[model samples]
Structure formats: C-alpha cells, structure tokens
Target chain A: MAGLEDLYREIILDHYRSPRNRGELPTPPAQRVEGFNPLCGDEVVLFVDLHDGTVADIKVSGQGCSISQSSGSMMTAAVKGKSVAEARALIRRFKGLMSIHEQALGGEADQLDEDGADGAGADDPDVKLGDLEALQGVVKFPVRIKCATLSWNTLTQALDEAPA
Target chain B: MTAVEAGRKAATPLDVARVQADFPILARRVHGQRLVYLDSAASSQKPRAVLDAMARFYETSNANIHRGTYQLAVESTEAYEAARRAVARFVGAPDPRGLVFTKNVTEAINLVAASWGGANLKAGDAVVLTEVEHHANLVPWLMLKDKLGIELRFVPMGEDYTLDLTHLDRLLDGAKLMAFTAMSNVLGTLTPIRRITDAAHAAGALVLVDGAQLVPHVPTDIAALDVDFFGFTGHKMCGPTGIGAMWARPELLEAMPPFLGGGEMIRDVRLDGFTTAEVPTKFEAGTMPFAEAVGLHAAVEYLGALGMDAVREHEVSLTAYALRALKERHGDDITIYGPSEPAMRGGALSFTYKGIHPHDVSQVLDQKGICVRAGHHCAKPLLRRLGVGATTRASFYVYNDESDVDALVEGLSDADDLFSL
Candidate 1:
C-alpha cells in the first residue's frame, strides 16, 4: 500500500470521482480528438474550442482508470481559458513529468520519444503545473504513465486540428 | 472407459498443497506478499517438470527434426512425434497424425481458416460462430470474411452467460462451417459442444472448436465431441510458449492445402513445381517446434498424472467457493460476469468491483500480490455485449486453492477502501 499511495494521491482520486469539464462538445464548433490506451481499453476523447489563439472552452469525456480519467480532468481544469501556446507548453511539461523517471530506467516509452526531447524539462521552473502536478506520481508506475498521458496526447491532437 | 466412467474415476480429490509445490513460481514473493496468481485463463505458470523436460531436450537431442539423419536429429524427431502423440491422446484424438504443431492457438485457428476454409469455402458461405469467442476465434474468420466475402453469423449468449442455442439451426442454416469456443476465456462459459456439433453436423456444416480455454481445464475427448477441428495452445496447459496445435479430422487434414510454404513439407521439389507432403507434414511447413513439443509432452504427462477430471473437480470446487465468497463479502458492490453454477463454467470470474475501473482494481490487487487480468480480456465484442469496457478477471487453476480466493476477496476490499467515494 506504500507504493499504492504514491500512484493514487488524494487529489488524483478527487478528480477521478468528479471529473472537471466532463461532456462532449458539438463537433462543428469544437475540434475533437480521441486517444486510446489499447492495452487496457482506456479511452480519452478531448473536445477543444480554440478561438483567437486561446482555448475558449475544453471538455474531456471518456472512460478509464483513475489515473487516466483524473489526469484528463486535471488537464481540462488547467488548460481551459488558457492560450493555445500555454496549453501546448503545459502538455509538453506534463508529458515531461510522466517520462522523466521512465527515461532514467531506460524503459521503452515510445510515445514519449516523439515529443522531441521535452521530457528533460519536467522540472522546468517557468512552467507551473498547479493541480496537474498530482499526476507526477504516475511515473512511479510505468504502465499507468500512458494512462496519465492519454488526455494530454489527445489534447495535443485536438489543438492541432483546431484553428490557430 | 467412457467419459462418465472417467468422471467417476476422478472422484479421488487432488492434493492441492502438493500440486502448488510442483510450480516453482508460486513460491516467489511479490511486494513482500505471496503471489496469488488467478490469471490462468490468460496463460498458466509452467511446472518444474515441463521446464526440466525442455532443458533435457536441448541438452540431449537438440537438432533439426525430420531433416538430418544424425543420431540427435533422429532422437529429436522421435521426441517431437511422441509429444504430438501424447497431446493428441490427451484430447482423445484417434490418430496423432492429424495433429499439426502451431505457434499458438491463434496460429492454429488461422491455419484452419486459411488452409481448410480457403480450399472449401466460397463467397457468401456462412461460418457460424458464437458471441463468447475470444479474438483468436473471431479475427481469423473476420479476415476470411474480408478476403473471400464469406458471411459470419454468431450464436448469441443468454442472460446466464451461456450460449443461446434457441436459433442454432437458423444461424447454422446454409453455413459451410460452425466455429465456436469450448470454453470462453473471459466468461468461463462451458458451452455444450456436443449439442452444437450435432446441430452443425445435421445442418451439413463442419465444426471447429476453440479449445484454448477448455482442453487445459477439463476432460476433453475430441472423438466423443466429434468436432471436425480443434485448436489449443501449450502455454495455457502448463506448457511452454511458441507451441500450440490444431487437431483436424484425417480427411479434412488430407484435403486442406499447406498453410506455410517452406522446407520439410515437400514430397518432391522439381525445377518447375513441387508436390506437397502427406497429412500432418503437409501443414507443418517449416522446422518443427522440437523443444517446445518435448515440453508439451512433459506438460501433458504432468496433467495426466494429476488427471484432468481431478483438475476439473478442483476448479469447480474452487470456483464455487470464489463465487460464494466474492458475493457474500461484497454483496451488491461486486458484479461477477459469468455462470453462477460452478459446474457450468471454468474458473474465470470476470467482475466489476464497486463501479471502479478494472485497471484500478487490478493495480490495487497487484500491490497485494494478487495477479488478476484487467481490461477487455481480448474479447472486446463480448465485453461490449456485456456492456462493460473491461473487467478484472481472476481465474483459478490446479495451483490455486481456497487461500488464493480469500486473498482476492480481501484485496477487493482493499481496492474498495482505496476508491471509496
């Protein structure tokens, strides 16, 4: 249970039980992207409303374990009403948090490899994670790292699809 | 002896403590706790005997089977063939010559679909399957459907998680083949194979039984069941990986084309074209799984000594205990998805605990050293039908005992406590 405590922090479970910005947005007004952890069937559907270089509204709707769903909820809370550039920076920083320990262990985090070396910036002082920092515990359990990052990756894809 | 007599002979209960000692892995500690492995439906842990047999094969008779005339090669070939005979006998196949060694059950099913189905089936021909089938049983037929335009029909699962055969004849109508599982990997539903085979035969259809989950758990007599083809894997039967088998009828094996084209399967290789080898060799194209066959032979011998009936009896009792314990402890909080009758199902108990996601439940359980499988269990369509994205499955085998089930019940409480809203 000592290891379990690190993986499921109190803040993380709160987000899972009561996910923030949870629902679907109409596709025409919002760009949607879905990320799947095929190993566990954990899915994350992101709907981002990017207007005038700002994420005017964002919602996450999917089903997954506490780590994935809570990470998604915390992500929506952090990125909503933020600039597109700010959101992308948060995504990189969050992924950095998830992949830092994985890189140290020399684990095969193929998903993290495509981010172009942003994983080393986990401790970047410029980026403040706020509630999103709760998910930093997920790196301890390597398999759940993908669950923690599923929403961030989907958010990245959603932002790419949205009008800049 | 008859199947019923075999069942009577299995009245001698197995010594579970002695059985656990045979598998070395069960003794190891995980997270400072004893390992309570309940995922045998996914893949079983091998015993010391199986391991020793494989090592012995490599040490003594490590050579290319059926290729060299050297002493080692001759011994290797004999050992491999003997393994095939033992595995075939375990399933009650009349002739060992009909058994073809495959990589795993997936490859075995694929071999049948590509070889037998390819040679016989045409566009619009229906291949009836069941809703409870694993992806191994489903994907191959789906691939054939995509390639040859063959129609696929499914026998629906009843509310009790058993196969609904109310319209079996209707689904098997005009069907060229009937493929289904003997026991579901996820639900542990023991299908009425003889009934299904009879219906399929009456409707002039050949039957293929996916025994990946069944052959390892119960008394399986392919001759008694009278199915055209049977596919199973070695890993699920306390044997090593990289080895499985497909047992087909002699006429069907003789008629079907070779699955993989390479050395060891040709009768005569000419400048222009080549003639195929005989029945079993015709399908076994490349190098045989020599060491794995030896391992499988030892595995079957081990299981034979334990007696499959005793194995089934142990599982049924353990499953009954688990079912009662899980429900009694958790009540409405735990929803186990399978047949309530232990006699009706295998040891796989797929469940959703306290509305918590299966991955979370499994993660919490893993900390307690309980190895349970979470997620779709490779039966996505079946999970969709059950209206759940995933489930935490705790399957029992000969190595598992009442204490393992108790650990699982206690671990679920721990998960419930951690996720209590």
Candidate 2:
C-alpha cells in the first residue's frame, strides 16, 4: 500500500493549515483568474498585479481540498516578488515535478514532454523549488495531480491576462 | 392479515454476510485492506447472478430482438421482453408495454423532458420542482424553461433537510407539471411521492418521479403512487450499467412524440414521412442493451427473492446504527446532513468531519480501503443552498453491514489525526 505520508507531507499540512498570501486583491490594479476542478467542485481564485516586468503582488482566495489550497498558498509565496519570466519558468518546472510520476504510470508522457518544453528547450533544470518540491508526491496519486496544479494553471491564466 | 401488517411481519433482516458473498468484489482487497464499499448511491456492485445472466444471454441467445423470426432471435426477444415484464412487476407497474429502456436514469428523464414536455408544454407553462432534486431532474426542466419560455418554481427545504410543503400548494397552483425526486442522492431525504402526486393531480398537473435513488433502496409502486412518469436506472440496484427504465401512463406515452428516431422505434419509414411505433417501442430507438436488460432482470429477481420490504427494514436499522455511531464517536466535530430519522431517509449519509475538506477526508479513508464519494454529488444547487462546496457521502446497500460502518468510523480518526492541525 502506498503510504499517505507520501501525499500528505508535514510541510503540506502546515501550508494547508495556514495558507500564505490568502486573501483578495483589488480588481482595478490586479488581474483575476479563476480555475475550477469540475470533477470535485474545487475552485482557485487568483489575483495578480504585474508592474515593470515583475509580479508586484499576488493573492489567492478560494475553497478546495488541502492539496489545492496549499499549492495555491505556495504559488503565491513563490511568485510574489519574482519576474514574470521567472514565474513562468517556475510553472514549467513545477508542472514537470507533478508530471514526472504520471509519465511513469504509463499516462500520456509524450504530450506532457511536448508541453513541458518551451522554446528554450528546458525549464532551467537548476531552478530552486524550495517548499514546492513537497507537492511532487502528488504524482503518486494521479487524480490529485490536478488538485496540486490547479493554482498554477490559474496563475498561467492570470499571467496571460495581466498587462505586460 | 392486512398488507401493512403482513409486510411488517415479513420484514426479516437480511443475512448480510451471505449477501456480501454474492457480490464478488466485496471479497477483494484494496490497498492491502478489506474493500469497504460505501459508494453504492453512485453505482452498486453487481451480484454473481446478474453477471451470470448477462453472460448467459450473450452465450446462449445472442441476437437482435423484435424483428428476427429465427430461433435465437425469438429467444432473445422473449428474454428481453421478459426482463421488461420483470422490471415492470418489480416497480408495481400494471403493464410492461409502458416501460421504455434508455441508457440510464439521466437519459430516462431526458426522454420525458424532450418527448413529453416538448409536445405538451408551451410558453408560460409552469413546472414545479423541489430544492432537493439531483441535476438529472433539475437541468431537464431548466432546459425546457429556456427553450419554451416556461416558468419553474422550487419548493424549498426546511432546516430539517426535508422539503417544506408549507408552500407546496402555492407552488403547484397553475403548474403544468411537477417533476421531483423520490429520494435525494445527496442528503438521503425521501420525499412524500404519494402526497405530492395527489396534490399535483388535484391541481390539474402531471407528476414525474425521479426514482434513481428511491427504487434501488426502497419499495416502489408507481401505480399506487399515481405518478404519470417514473424514471430509474439499473446500475444502482446491483445490475449492470447502460440500461435504465422510464414508466409512464399509457395515454401519455401514446400522445408523446418519439425522442430519438431510428430503426426499432419506427413502424415504417419513407422519404416523404414515417409513422411511429406503439407506446414503448415508439420511444426505444436503437439496438438496445439486451444483455444489460438480462442483468437487470436477474437483479430484480435477486431483490424479489430477498424481498424489498426486508431490504428496506435492513437499511433502516443499519442507517440508524450508522447515524448514532457517527454522532457518538465524533460528537460536535462532525456535521451530518439529512433527516435524523432513518425511516424518513435511505442509507446515504453525507457529512463533514472536523471542518476538514471532504476530498482530504476521502483520500485518507482511501488508504484504509474505504470507498466513499466526496464531491458535490451532482446536486450543486442544493450544496450551494447549504453553503458548502462539497460533502463526503457514505451510502449503504444490501451487501453492506455494520462492520463496514465500523471501518468507516475508524478511518475517520485516521483522517482527524493527520489533518487536525
């Protein structure tokens, strides 16, 4: 039996208990994007403020399971002061982390390989993940992979809608 | 003895261990633990008899039904109609000719909405519904309201999680139809179908009962209930998927147009026009699931041998046990949603634990091989009404026993330990 400790790490529980950057940002200065897992009715609402090629501020407010809310919390903390390009790279790296075991599970590895590689051919493999690496265990449970990536998907949408 | 007294006297409890043995999957282990399946409301595990009947149909009498004059085809047709007859008798319908087989309950309800509602209803017609309906019952009427400029009114739920009938008279006033569920899939709230049908008939309206959750768990008598239409699926009652039934009054079935046009549903077809078939065949369009029908026949026979009254009695006692056990073990940390009385509801128990998200709770329980559904349960409107995103639902069936409930309760403590913070 696969242990629950693999999925629910202590750090993940801590993040779930006290989510970081958990609130709403004003709509006028912040671009908002919402992501929903229709399978489970989990929602992730993101508000992003971009200025001078940097993510000036970001906040997450939504209701979901522990993996989703904790992932959103970690995502806001990671991208709060980073450049947009850096955040996009981190998104690629984080998605790579989530999909690694999914590929091993005989899923659509080819399509994910294509999606993971940007024009740069690699997502800067040396990128530091910090606490985000804890979510890599979510790949063991494939259904929950979406829960972990929901916030990042919403972040991608927010970046697309945010003014450059 | 009167029928009620006889029924009560004959409500012998089921031998759950033997019943569990009839389902092969219950013996299988999940995650190195006993598989405690509590998600029967979504779909049930098929017994050995149902599985064998379906295989036997394909092996012995596999042929397209209704048209062929050959030996195998005739046998196939007989078996299919016999299944229909068995299901009709099971639900207390007077005639099998009024029952039409569709893919599932959702399709069954859609047939009524599109075929009957489309032909009979016009703009400004009102359809009264209740707040406790699954999306299968609610969305069809909503689609009709959009297409035909009709009005839809809902009977709200009281604080007790049952429908508040205080305004039912006003809601049914001048309505063209009243469509609702006999049992709620989310909260396990059983509606008073006979009373509501009486009111609808008195108000000069038709009634359609969504029996997807009701017929599987309790005794259903469509004729006694006096409803115009009754829809339910086979998979939730220990039968295979891809087969469901809709029973309607003969006159309504005769008056309604065919839902899907195809080979079996037509009497004759020409380039200019075509004539529809008789009542039941008029609605059945394609080469239907004959094997699934065989499975359903065996399933109903299995239930009949066990007796639905006994099944209902067993669930009532089991639900009462679960309700009390959960409350006693968890105390205020748990919030179960539904009517408190087991007789008023079925075995579905939707709850929240220690303010933890339902998904997380279900994930932890999964480690212990406990299968419970954790989601909006296709009742988003009702969940929104309750102001919760989702709930963890543990529903019981004929095969489940108190041991499964014990596993679930023990598994919750595991969840609490990990996510208590």
Candidate 3:
C-alpha cells in the first residue's frame, strides 16, 4: 500500500488547498494558455504577464485530481516574478528533475547554440529545484509523472508563446 | 455441439470459489478486504487457461513465425495461424484471411485510417462517426481529415445516450465511411449496429464498428451484420494482453493496400522494389506476438465454451439489477447516464453523485476494495456533451454477479456518508 503521505505529501496538499497565484491576471498584458493531462483529465489555464524582459505576473486556474492541481499551484508559486531567461532555466531544471535525467538539462543547454553563447547558462546556473525536487519521486510511477509535469509543461508553453 | 450443450458443459457462472481460483489477483487484499474488480471495461482479469497457453507456447515453441523451416518455427507459425482462425470464427467472419492482428483496437483503427482511409477518402469525402467514440476511433480519423482534407462528421446521441438515427440518414449524405461503437464503454448504450450499417450501406458508405466493448459480452456475427470492418482487443475478451484483431471483408482487404511494410507482410524483396504478401499477412508488419496469439485462441475457445449468449444474458440481468439497486439506494441524488433499460445497454454504467467529484468517489470506492474507473474514460467529446468534466464508471463482466453490484452500492453509500451531502 503506497502511503498517502508518500504519494500526497503535506506540501502538495497544502498547495492544492491554498494554491498560490490561483486566479487570472487582467487582459492586454497577460497571455492565457491552457494545458491538459489527457490521461487523468486534468486541465489548467495559465495566465502569464511579461513586463519588459521579466515575467511580471502568473496565475493558474483549473480542475483536476490533486496531484495535477497541486503541481499547477506549485508551478505558479515557483516561477512568479522571475525574468524570462530565469523562468526558462527553471523550467529546464524542473523537467530534468521530473524526468530523472539531470544530465539531459546540461545537454539541452549546450545544444541551444543561440542561448549558449549569451551566458544564459551562467546567468541561471543549475540551481537546485527546491520544493520541486519532491516531484522527482514521480519517475518511479511512470503514469503519475504526467500528473506532476502537466502544469510545468503548460507554463513552458505560456512562456514560449507569450507576447514579446 | 448445440448451444444448450455448450452452456451445460461450460464452467459454472463465475461463482465465488471459481472466480477466486481463476483470478490469482482476487485472492490478494487491496485496501484490507478482497479486491472487488468492477473495471472490466478497462481491462479484464486473465484466466489461468489464457495465462498458461502463453507460457506453454513460449516454453516449447518460441520462434519467429512464417520465416523458418525448422520444427519449432513451423509449430509457432501453425499456432499463430490457428489463433487467426479462432478470431475469425469468434466474430463469425467467413475466412481467417480477413483478420489482421494488431497490438490493440487503437492500432487496428489506425491501420484502417492510415491505409484504407488514406487511400480511398478524398478531399470532399465525409467520415460519419459517433460522438461517443473513444479517442482511438476519433483521433485516427481526425488525423486523416487533417492530412487528406476530408470532412469529419458526428452523429448525435439523444439525452438517453442512444444514437439519434433519425438524423443519421440526413448526415449520411456524401458520407464515405461510418465508424462507430457497438457499445459505449462509459455510457454503456448499445448502438443499433444493424440499422446503422444497413443505412450506411444504402448511402453507399463503408461501415467500421468499434467492438472493444461489444465483443466481450455479446455474440457478434460480422457477416450477418454486414459491417465492412470490425475492431476488438484480446485483453478485454478474456485473452492475454498485447493482441487484438481487425476483421474486414475479404474483398475490401484485397482492395486496400497494406497498412505496414516489414518482414512478414512481404512476399519477395528485390533491390528495386518488394511485393506484398496475402490479405492478412500484408497487414501484419513485424514479427507477430505468436504466444499472445495462441493465448487469444485459447481465450476465444474459453468464451465459446461458456457461450456468448449466456454471457450476454448474465450481464444484461446483472446490469439491470445494478441499475435498480443503485437507483433505489441513491434515489434522485445519482445521475446515471445511458438508457434506463439494461437490455438496451451493456454492463458499464457512468454516473455522477450530485455533490461529489468522481475522483473522490473512486478514492472512497478504492478504500472499500472496489475498483472502478474515474475520468472522462477516453471519450472527451461525449463527456463534454454530457456537461460533465468527468464521471465514475463501474463496468461489469462475466465474472461479476449480484454480490459485486451490492459491494458497489455499499461503496457508493460509504462515499456519500463520508462526504455528508
């Protein structure tokens, strides 16, 4: 029996109960992006605002199973008020951590020929993905990894397509 | 042997002792009590017979089929072909040549969509599919539509979850193909296949029936129904996993090009080009799952011995009892989707408790050792039409009886009590 404590840690439940950046920002400046976990029918709409070169605001709203919803809530809290470059670095680090291929993050940074030259690597050095490290346990359960990464993936999409 | 003799000779109707013995998993306690499996629609419990068939094949005659001349190779090829024959007979197809084995029903539909559909359907051609189709059927055609510029149309369902065939005739105009489910996995409505097929044929359209939900419970005759294509999975029909069959008319299969090109599906390879093999062999690309095929054959024989008619009767009666019992217990608080008449539906039932989320319901049911699927159930469009994000589904199978239904009712009551709504 997988303990509820192991699968649904206290931090996860807390995020689900009282999500951070849980509502939509105003229009004109923010872009709305929707992501779905087709496996468990988890959906999240992320509203991201870009001010100059920084992510000025981010809000997430959706309905899903606890893992997905909490992951979304945590994602918003983690990336809010960061610069675009910093947010991208955080996403890469988070993905690498979730996929259990930490080396791939280093490989991806090297492969980004354009970004590689600009010291994007040095600017956002491989900082330990703190609370997000909890999701590293999801790799053992292949099916649940999607639940953990759905919001992060959505965040990436919102950031990529965000109006410059 | 006559159907009556077959029924008499078959094993008892999945009694507690028989069920416990056949499914090794049932002996284990999940959340404390014995596991009450009600998610057969997702996948069925494997019997010892099917399991042993695979093991026996692998232990003795494991070889790549149809390529080698050795004794083991010959035996493996024979076993695989015998499984094809069993599948053909199981679905009442005239020739085994018409059946093509794939990984599962999803791959089967994709084979048709990519090969036959891609070849024949043109820019203005329309594909008529039902709203209740699983993503397996829906996505493949959508992919074809995007690639080939074909129009994808949907046949609407009534509030009762039955297909609205009155508008089907109108929608059939300029339709090239009609793909639909014989029974919905979620709502459990049994679509009128005969009428739908006949009307589609009259409209000069090909019909493909998704029989993943239908083949397990009911006796199906492809020739009698006059459907052009039928797809079903092995695991759902008491067979081993990783095998499924698609039955097409021999002529239609001959007309269509091969779905996949590889070792088995080739006849002669030259430096310039290669020639394709026969009807079924042309469709089977790589090395087939020989052991899985043998297990599927054993599964078909097992179902035949039990008799599909009796199985259907047992399920219909059980579904009726379940509907009545759940409705009695929950009253107006429960919203059961699909037809009220069990005879008009299959064994699955998707429902929503007024105040409870389906995930919460499923979690509570899990505590009671009752396993039911909770989600959109791979039918997002249909769920959206039903105005719900998700629902909890409890599906029944041959092993299920009245007691299982009682357990489900008890579990739901427990859920309601815990939620206090």
Candidate 4:
C-alpha cells in the first residue's frame, strides 16, 4: 500500500518538478553521452567536462518518468564537484545500496523504509550515501531500477569514453 | 412474459457474462479492488478455452511435429496445421497454403524484411511506410536499410491524426513496397486499407499490412483488401503468446528466401548448399510452438463463434461510450488523440489527463486496480510526431463493458486530483 508513496517520495517529486543541471554543456571540453530506455522512451543526455583528470562540470538534459528524471537531477547534484573516480565510486555505492535493499525487501514487501530498515550495510559506519541514498527505495519497484540507475550508467560510459 | 424475462429471452450477442466466465483472470482482485483490466492493446487476457486447449494438447498429443513417425507425433502435426488453417480462415485469406506461422507479429514482419526485403530491395530501391507504425514495423526496415542501400519514404500525418493521402501518390511512386499498419495501436486511427492498397498497386508497389491492431478488432478479408502480406499476433486477440501468423501471397511466399535457417525449413541437408522446403514450411524454422498454436486456434474459434462483426459492434459502442464519458466529465482538461469518430478507429484510446504526465496517470490508476498502458507504447516516432513524450492508453475488448469505462474515468479523476493538488 505504501509502495507508491515510497516510490514517489516528496524529494523525488521536487527534483522532478524543478530539476537541477537541466541543460547541456558545450562540447569542446565536455563529452556528451546519451542513455535511452527503449521500454519507456526515457532518455538522458549527460554532459561532463573532465579537465586535468578531474570532473569540472556536469549537466543533465532529458525527458522521462519521475524516477528517471529525478534520479538524473539528484545525480548531477551529487557528482558535480567530485572527481571522475569519485563519481564512479558513488555509482558503485548507489548500485550496491539498490542491490542490498532489493535483497532485504524480498518479493512480498514491495516498499522500503525512508532509511534502510535492516540498515542494509549502512551500519558499516563508512557508507555516507548523501542525497543519492534517497533512491535506495527504488529497489522495491523492481521495474524502475533501470530508471534510477540510467544516468549513473551513462556517466560511467561517458567517463570510459573520455581519454585520461 | 414479464419484462425482465422477455429481455433475458432475446439474448445479447456477446453474452458478456458468459464471456467474462471464460477468462479466469477476470475473477481475480487487484490491489484489493475489482480488476478492471483495460490494457488489452498491450496484450489480451487468455480465455479458459485457450488455456484448456493448450493443456489438453500437452496431455494427449505431446510430441515434436513434422519429423516423427509415431501416432502421437502425427496428431501433434495435425493440431499444428489445423491451427494454421483456423487462423487463415479467420483472416479471410484467399488460400490457407500461404499462411506462415511466426513467433509473433514482430517476427512475422522481420521474416518479411530478411526474406522478401533482402531479396528484392537492392540499392536505390524505395520502401513506403507510414509515420504511425509500431516500432516492430519501422525498426526492422531501418535495419534492412542499414545493411542494404535503400530509401524509406514516409507518409506524413494529417492534422486530423489520420494519414494525409494527398501526397501518398508521390510517396508510393517508384517505391517497391508500401508497408503500413491497418490500424494505429496508439491513436485508434483505422487507416483506409483499400484506398492505400489501390494507390500502392497503381504505383506498381506491393502492399504489406501490419494487422497487429486491426485483425483483433475488425473483420479482415485479405483478398478484398488486396494486400500482399498481412502480419498479426495471436495474444492480442485472446490467444496465448508465442504464436502469430503472416498471410502472404502464394507467389511472394514462393519467391522469398527462407528467413531463419534451421532443421524444419530445409528439404535437403547439405553443408555446401541446401534446398529449402516449400512456402509455409520454408518460413517456419525450427520446431514450432505447437501448444501455443493450439491455444490460438481455440481463441480463433471463440472469436468466430461470437462473430467478428458482433465483436466490432460491441467494441465500437463501448469505445464511443468511454470517449463520451471521459470527455463529458473532464471537458477541455482531457486531450484525446487520433480520430474522434468511433467508426473510424478501434477500441484503443490514447490521451493525456489534466496535463499530468502519462506515467504519473498510469501509476495512479494502477493503485486503483485500473490497468492502462503508459509511455510511447512501442510507437516512439508517432509520439514524437504528436509532440508528446508518452500517452496513457485504455483499450477495450469483448468482455469490457460500461462499468469498466466508468472505473477508468474514476481512475483518471483520482490521478488528476493526485497530481493537481
């Protein structure tokens, strides 16, 4: 019953309504990458500027459902100042959080608590997920896990494509 | 006789109560509410008859077809071929021999693209297609064009949402094939088949009709329509998944190469060169989905017994009612796509509610046990043409009634309130 509430969290809706880093950056120093979820027609064009082996500016532009659009918005905010390696590390952390939450929720409980209930490895005392952890509940809605991770995957690809 | 007794004696054509009885899923609840299933355009719910038919086949005649000499295998082969014949007659094919069983409509169209398209379409050859085609029809042709140098000319959409036939002659001119959908699954626009077929013929181009949306809703006669190849899936018409059919002209079937190379499609086994089996068998590669085919046969019988005309009649009335009910309640807040007239379309209705995104609307509806499809609906190009990211579509079937429409309207109202607030 609370699954929809968990999915469409107030923070998620706010990001969806008024997204951050919502436009493209020029292509000279920026590498542009596109991610598409053909099933739902969701797409993200992520622009990243990597200078001197560090991430300078990140911008996201696209149209999609709340889950995808909001995740893209949060992703830009979380990774804007981090180095390319740090951004990749955050991607791993977020994906690990989603996987852990998925295992905890099981099939019957399609909703996760605002904070990880079983603490889902959060008790490690070293995992500080920041704003990106808001997406941990996305694992409850299994179909939309792709939506929550689309931009991060695209960012990974963008980094891989860019030269060292 | 009493009024109620007299009314009961006449007997409705659909006997919806009886129809509902045939689908076991209809009896189930969703989200603690009555399951008002309206997502048939995505795929139809199977009737008990189809399910039983498949189960009975597995129980009685469980063997590989076309290879074994045992009695069970012969029975399996007959059942498979009988389903083919049933599908052929259901679509009013001039001859059942041209029927080729495919996995689904997408596979059927792909078979044509690889087999027929690859053979005939050389460099500089042109193919005409409409803008409203499902990705299943458009993407394969694009892939073919990428492999072979060919041109794809599109028929533009009119402001009224139907195909603008004014420039159709120009599009078809010099085109080797005019491939289009008989009905738009997104907009519910029933494209004029006979007119398009005639124009394509006059332009000296063969006609290929994607009947995935049309055959399930209307009475189809391939001979009368003068189409070269007609493609459709079984699941959209109360049949099971994993089975579909393509009715192509006998000559075209004979002329094209085998699409998939496998054990069943070849006549002689030689590593250097193999001779292909004839027509339908040639196209049917590997062991067929005979159980699903048996289920599809039962579905065809179910529809045939109800009469396609009656099915169309029931759907039109229901669609018209739903349209009026939705518009009447919402007024200008609702924007419905495709043709406004029910006669000019099928039961599928695509629309946006209260300027809320279709995904949001569908999510809200899902909470209420009202099933509807949202997103590009496998017709992304069409949605882009319409200047929308996605649409929420509620399609009607034989078992759907006025109450289902009411539930849909109620669900939309809930969605509007949830978003607007």
DockQ of each: 0.69, 0.83, 0.26, 0.44
Candidate 1 residue lDDT tens string, A1-164: 24998989899999988889999889878888889888898888888888789989998887999999999999999999999878877877888777776666564366566654355544577879988877777877877887887888888778776664
Backbone Cα, N, C clashes tallied per candidate: 0, 0, 0, 0
Write candidate 4's Cα lDDT for B129-181 as tens digits. Answer: 99999999999999989999899999988999999999999998899999999
Between 1 and 4, whose lDDT is larger? 1
Q: Quick one: best lDDT, which candidate?
A: 2
> Which wins on lDDT, candidate 2 or candidate 4?
2
Pairs with steric clashes in candidate 4:
none
Q: Summarize candidate 3's per-residue lDDT along B1-421 as a digit string, tens digits.
A: 9886576446355344564477667778886887889999999998788888888998999999998999999999999998999889999987789999999999999999998998899898999999999999999999988899999889998877898887888899879899999999889999889999999999999999999999998888888888999999999998988999899988888889888888888889999999889888899989888888999998998888777877887888899999999999989989999899988999999999855668767877876789999999999999999988889999988778788899999888876765542
Q: DockQ order of candidates, best first? A: 2, 1, 4, 3
Query: Model 3: runs farther than 4 Å from truth?
Result: A5-23, A49-58, A70-149, A152-164, B1-16, B413-421
Model 4 segments beyond 4 Å from truth?
A49-56, A83-85, A100-124, B1-12
True contacts kept of 2: 0.93
Clashes of 4: 0
TM-score of 1: 0.97
Residue-wise lDDT of candidate 3 within A9-97, one digit each (tens)?
A: 66766776677888888876788889987766778888889888888888888777666777788777777788888777777666655
Q: Provide the global lDDT of candidate 3 against the true structure.
A: 0.83
Best by DockQ: 2
Q: Give per-residue CA lDDT, model 2, range B91-209, as digits (tens).
A: 99977888999899999999999998999899999999988889999899899989998899999999999999998888999999999999999999999999999999999999999
Model 1 C-alpha lDDT per residue in residues B113-166, reported as the tens digit of each score: 998889998899999999988999999999999999999999999998999999
Q: Write the per-residue lDDT of candidate 2 for residues A82-136, one digit (tens) a residue.
A: 9998998888788777766656665446645655633352356677889998987
Query: Stretches of candidate 1 above 4 Å error?
Result: A100-113, A117-123, B1-3, B6-10
| Model 4 native-contact share | 0.46
